[model samples]
Target: MNWMEDGMTSIPNVLLQNYKRLQIEEKEMMVLLHIYSFTQKGISFPSFEDLAERMTISSSDCAACVKKMIQKQVVAIEQGDQTGYEFYSLKPLWNKIAALFESDARGQSLQQAMTAEKDLYSLFEEEFGRPLSAIECETLALWIDQDEHDPSVIKAALREAVMSMKLNFRYIDRILFEWKKQGIKTVDQAREQGRKFRKPTGTEQVTRSENAVPFYNWLEQ
Candidate 1:
């Protein structure tokens, strides 16, 4: 039996469908799909230990599986100086594989749509100084794929958050939501607001709140 038939026999039909569309090795595919599940729920990428626990395998075996996946172009791996392995999806390859199983007319359109969205995300990252988190990247990708949001405005906000505020993903998201509530959608407007927020307020007080005391500062019982 072929890989597809084997997959159908061994794995659930819903999972098998996702696996086929990604064209990844069975072990790697299973782990990747599980990781993808966490992403769908707004969690960032899973760690090596997390992957090992989920797969019910040793860390070494999980490492090997991940390495093989990196080789297969199903996932991209980044090793940090102090931090460890970071995995990201190889969306282009997955999109191509997905297109192959779709109707010919729809396949071409879907392929084009995926490619365009990827290009737009590349532009977003380029405009921003640093890489986005997995959740942020996936959110942008989904929005672009659906063509429901303005890429230019989103890119501008991302750039403003990265450049003006010393903001991470959480802070950036907060600023984005605040801007949205205030009906500030354009890049220029975001940049202007960022500039205003960044200016030092001479009279601003650094008052400590009631919860500001450290754990060690609390009196012993």
Candidate 2:
């Protein structure tokens, strides 16, 4: 059944959330609802005559209401198409909705960013085997964000330090400095470079390794 036959149409409540404050009169509101109904039914070119014929409004009144809607920027019309008016812009509606919700959207985005930063802090603590000091946290952030180093590369450097039994920030810094000198900017490159610098595995090799000395052992020496 045609919607016009039953005089039934549904309007989205959100579109009319500010309907009472729209600065349009009662008859104009009725015309706007008619436009909504026609648009929902896929009738791009709605007939003002048919609308006026069904309602108590005259065709002239309905036309005047459409002009008012266009002036208010609530509706738009394109002139060139043979369909009389082919384009109807809902930009005004979009502007209103964005104004209503932009703050909430930004708040959500800020919260997500803060959560991610905290997560990175926790990850660094776990990897470093202790709570990060303020300066240490800043250095980690600098590597990831300012220096544009990948977090995985930083983690690989951390793991490299741990494996060498020199789990110190200064040791990690040395690894980063060496990789930077070797043009390594990613975990894959770091791994390949690690392989290039790896020593032979044996008791004799361990005895010959410079990395066999811990940080505290060097201080005591």
Worst 10 residues of 1 by lDDT: 212-221
The digit string of per-residue lDDT tens for model 1 on 1-221 reads: 58555332223454466655555667777677666665555554677787788777776777787677767666675454687745455464455555665666687887886676677678656755567779878777654445344455555555555555554556655655687777776666666676676554544423334334342211111
**How many clashes show up per model?**
0, 0
lDDT of 2: 0.73
Q: What's the alpha carbon RMSD for model 2?
A: 8.6
The numbered model that scores best in lDDT is 2
Q: Give RMSD (Å) of candidate 1 vs. truth.
A: 22.5
Estimated TM-score for each candidate:
0.33, 0.49
Query: lDDT value for candidate 1?
Result: 0.60
Consecutive 10-residue window with the lowest summed lDDT within model 2: 212-221
Model 2: CA > 4 A from native: 1-43, 47-76, 81-86, 90-117, 180-183, 199-221
